[model samples]
Target chain A: MAKTVDAKHIISITVENKPGVLARISGLFSSRGFNIDSLAVGETEEPTLSRMTIVVKGDEATLEQIRKQLGKIIDVVKVQDFSGLDFVERDLALLKVNAPAAKRGEILQIVEVFRGKIVDVGQRHLMIELSGPEAKIEAMIALMQPYGIKEVARTGRIAMVRGVK
Target chain B: MSKKSKTSKPVERGREPKTGSQILVDALIAEGAQVIFGIPGGALIDVFDALYDAPLRFILTRHEQGAAHAADGYARATGRVGVCMATSGPGATNLVTGIATANFDSVPIVAITGQVPTNLIGNDAFQEADITGICRPITKHSFLVKDVKELARVIKEAFYIASTGRPGPVLVDLPRDVSRAVCEGNPSSEISLRGYKPVYEGNIKQIRLAAKVINDASRPVIYAGGGVIISGASEQLRALAKKAHIPATTTLMALGAFPEDHPLSLGMLGMHGTAYANHAVMESDLIIAIGARFDDRITGKVDAFAPHAKILHIDIDPASISKNIRVDVPVVGDAKNILENLIPLVEPAEHKEWLKTIAKWKKDRPLTYSDTGLKPQYIVEQICEATKGEAIIATEVGQNQMWAAQFFTFTRPRSIITSGGLGTMGYGFPACIGAQVGCPDKIVFDIAGDGSIQMNIQELATAVNNQLPVNVAILNNGYLGMVRQWQELFFKKRYSHTTLTGSPDFSKVAQAYGAEGRLIEKKEDVRPALEEAVASPRTFVLDFHIDPEENVFPMVPAGEALDKMIDGLA
Candidate 1:
């Protein structure tokens, strides 16, 4: 059986901020069919350099090709999949779960296990803040469906390498 | 005046008065434009009349959309701005989708639209439309010519803006009065504009830093993007990769940057990327991104994406360097020119160990899919093998697109012309029309999906009329495969209106247009059908009844990483 697994592949690439570079990268993605998930970019310390964090979800085969292409770009500095390494990946999610006094305890216990904190406690609603892995947050949302999910504010996912050294 | 009337010789020597239509033809010829693809309209009668007498070549298409698409083909094929003229109202509106298509893909196109008489500008006159305003967002620039004297200059400006900077479509709306007016100016004279200035040179300081970083990193991977192809730097990229011994991967648009069969070539990257290609980028210490942007599909999860590597992004657009994914070293210049300079500065390394590791990863899991059922892959494979992997292909959007991307092994640049940026449904047929127009010597195939082909099916008439023959291989899955794939994965296969059960008989349709059309039911017939189609003197449309339920494997279910692909048909 061909087993397919999805993972977050993050890279902190640095490059000179010039013209047509984006078109090149975008053209690369489109022509090669590198389907990205969430892509965020910000300027780095140098005025001419910028940092790009790209999130893609595909099989291992796909991720490998994506890394190679991402790295090959003249503007790209580096690409890495920190999932197996010491990288902390988190997605911020805002959940508005319907909460009355009757089942508040059940929801609260579940939120605590997920390390969530209450942002607002209205008469019939409890807005909680949860920041964790994308899958975990997604699972949490699924479990709270019985409690009634009024709204959801998800900030996709952002990652940083983790280490004690 | 009285003396002139009597003197016969001087009176007869006055230059002939040119109609509005004549001026348009004159201006186009002066601009070095040889072709005009468009439909003849009542408002544009004068222009057509003049066009007939002029030296310019005009391809009168059946539909306005076909005309626009033909222009798209002409422009993309020749790397020159293609010109097409249409009347106002229905004629102009019919071209909206094609204009947007060119705009999204950033192709060099010039569209000319006729308008109502000057007196009836604001009123809803017959065959009148506010095309200038209507095409605002869809065009890089648009001009509404109220004065006939400014027609030539406006057209010149339109062409300049379209083909120069990040190529896109531009429109020039000519009112009836303006077309009829006498505007005298040399279209080829030295033109100046204080408004437009596009930067072509790179920042030296940044280029030097980029060179240093690349030289410092031992385990480096070269990631080529579509910019390499757009900038025509495939040779430069090849030179750099060979000299530096840096393994490379390309995005879809960058398919031709390096030969796919090359040992250094890791194949395409992103959702359906090969295991080795993604692993090399993930594991490498330094990533040299050339002319590619950091798209969301390529990076599964940013924090974890290529954590071990440092990125050096080179692009022509300043905003793209750090717009989506940040880069450590930003080199903004033309990909070809920049790579040419950087290749000489870097030290060549054997890196056999690193290359071996990547090869090991590649072997661990080749992009394998079983021919277990009736799917587009079967057909795509046959096409590749039949063409000996040396044919130019244009693909329409949907499952057929995915199949082509996965199964086709392209070895050169511009070999595959598909709508990657916009994913326009009907893009395959029109794009192939353009590709074939550009490279008629090579056997060109339009790998189309049933749903996508219907979007521009009218082009068959244009194909037959113009005698620009191309083989159209339709993977008739009876659904908008891409959208259906999405619904199956995310929406639990509710199977909305995406499914198409009984479409118009493609063979009958093709025959009606005076072209050969073949319908293949069994797998064995694919190759034979392909051969017959290619052998035909005229354009051919081969429709295959692929399994509608067949799904493209190696799919990354919406918010997952590249490694987490969903295998098998859903």
Candidate 2:
């Protein structure tokens, strides 16, 4: 029943900014075999503190278990499943694909359709830039595969609650 | 809850005023802390007052080091960030080593230290030191909260960073005045940083490229590392291996990624790894490295690791790719995703010649072990079989660790957990707690040595109090076996302080912790004791007093060239 889903669950947890606190939180999730989703950490309004916004995906039970276990972290003050809340999720993708003279126009056309901008064009290659949910970017990249893609780099999903609670 | 008032117990003479500490304690409990592990300090008496009335259970330990380790144990055991508190100066420094150990092992822990009063701070005053600076290198992040208003928010963020990507340890330092200052209700806020974006998904092109590589590889070998275990990709690894017909070998940290007994499975590779395994690497033309970096231990002479093979390294961290060894194709992605894409790329290639070639190497240089007087191999085999090979075996790093890798048949990936990367001596017990927490149905045992067991023996109490069923199998060789062997071979047998002669009775120690403890005096008693230990409802410790002079052979000396191995028994 353990399966890897495509959508990485995002969790926003609040905690005291103290020593060894990070280890405690990560240890909990790691122990449960929940690899962290995209992790973005920074200080909150309090100068002495910080906040960790994480995204990871697992089964319903695992996600709940992860949340419950996170409560045990010594420095953690709160755990929230931001993905389940009203939030905006976005990801960035950069792809390197071959662009022949014959296909250059078609490639540019495809890029514009995906709202992707042409970032670079070297000898016989085109680099496209796009930002959105993971699946949309993936679909765009898949469409460009037949053109003999050279390389693709992506920033995993990062999200925020739509309306700040 | 204890109906204790703040003023019920009078503050100690050297303590600060009660009102300030009460405020600190109230804020801590408001943050939902159930218990804390730490020691008291002279300057933080005000915080203690708050702790008394807040219904928080504080478990005091013998030393700050023990407190931190205890917190680490709790974190690992409960899947939570373990918290430890200590006063400034020596108290904070005492927690440093434990914090570093947790960092190395990737354990989530939160440490709190009480600094000297704000006015008296940084004056070389009594019991003051720059703990933040000293711990900066060891912690994921550190904090110094001068104002009490920031304490709540600081603690909130500490938990967040600790549990996030690639979990590690973090520290929070509070001055005496800060802990006492009154803070408003929970300081709820958002976090925004420019530098902290963790990548979760794999690159689509890289996934396709990995697929293409698998499709083209005539003699491909899959090398898995600890990240596979961390990401829980054993099932996906197996699916990819079976679909692609690629032989799989695991790095030390990824022992359980694929079934050890699989036909396409080659045992561990590297310096001390089986000769057949190393030969397979040299013979293969393609190496698909998954969730593993090319560490020196795995790739003996780096330049020669896979000279003939075109290496495809896929990892979560981009820096890990081509960090140690070179790579032809670098895929920055999760192991499971990459494997999923590769499955479709495998075109049913019944490459008989490649399989036969690898088979020849396996037959010529098969792994071997002997059954001489009181063979530890026999003990390992019996226990593994007795537990149906489903047990999560934890080993103290060294020869026994390698021996366990060599002998034990692991059918399930992630079943055999150990201190692979760090090779820490005291990691066995606490890691077993973590493993047990992860897989409650499996038998979790820490196979320890006489020397390694004593490193963090106090964890026995944690296990006992929590009622976690774990077995401690001590292979009492009376020495730090690995170091002793090195000395025996290179230093003309001038054994240093490695010998553990006339140590404390481990059985009595176990008894003190309210658990079953047995001493295996005779060789025949070993199996029965093992069975009894595994079946016991409580924590069990089996101490086997073994021959002091025995040694584990097949050692590869550090920095002495790959072939300069002193493997007499091999």
Q: Judged by TM-score, which candidate is best? A: 1
Candidate 1 wrong stretches, greater than 4 Å: A1-165, B1-20, B184-189, B300-305
Which regions of candidate 2 deviate over 4 angstroms? A1-165, B1-85, B346-351, B413-417, B433-442, B465-468, B512-514, B547-549, B560-570
Candidate 1, residue B139: Cα displacement in angstroms equals 2.3
lDDT of 1 by residue, A1-165 (tens): 123687657655555465444554555677678776766566777777665666777776566566655554434555556657678777789999999999899999999999999999999999999999888898999989999999999874667777666
Q: How accurate is candidate 2 locally (lDDT)?
A: 0.73
* Candidate 2 lDDT over residue span B1-570, tens digit each: 134435356545644433445545554565555567788897666677667667877766656776776576556544467778899899999888778877765667888888887888779988898787777656776777776656656676677667655566878888887776755333443443323444557778877777777788788888888677656678988888787678888877678778888988887877667666666677778898988877778887665566678888888666566656767888776777666766776676666777798788778656665555565666778789879888888787776687677778877765665655556677677667645544567788888888888887887876777677988888777788888888888899999988778888899899988988898867788788888888887899988876666565444466543444455564
The TM-score values for the models, in the order shown, are 0.73, 0.68
| Every candidate's lDDT | 0.76, 0.73
Count the clashes in each prediction.
122, 39
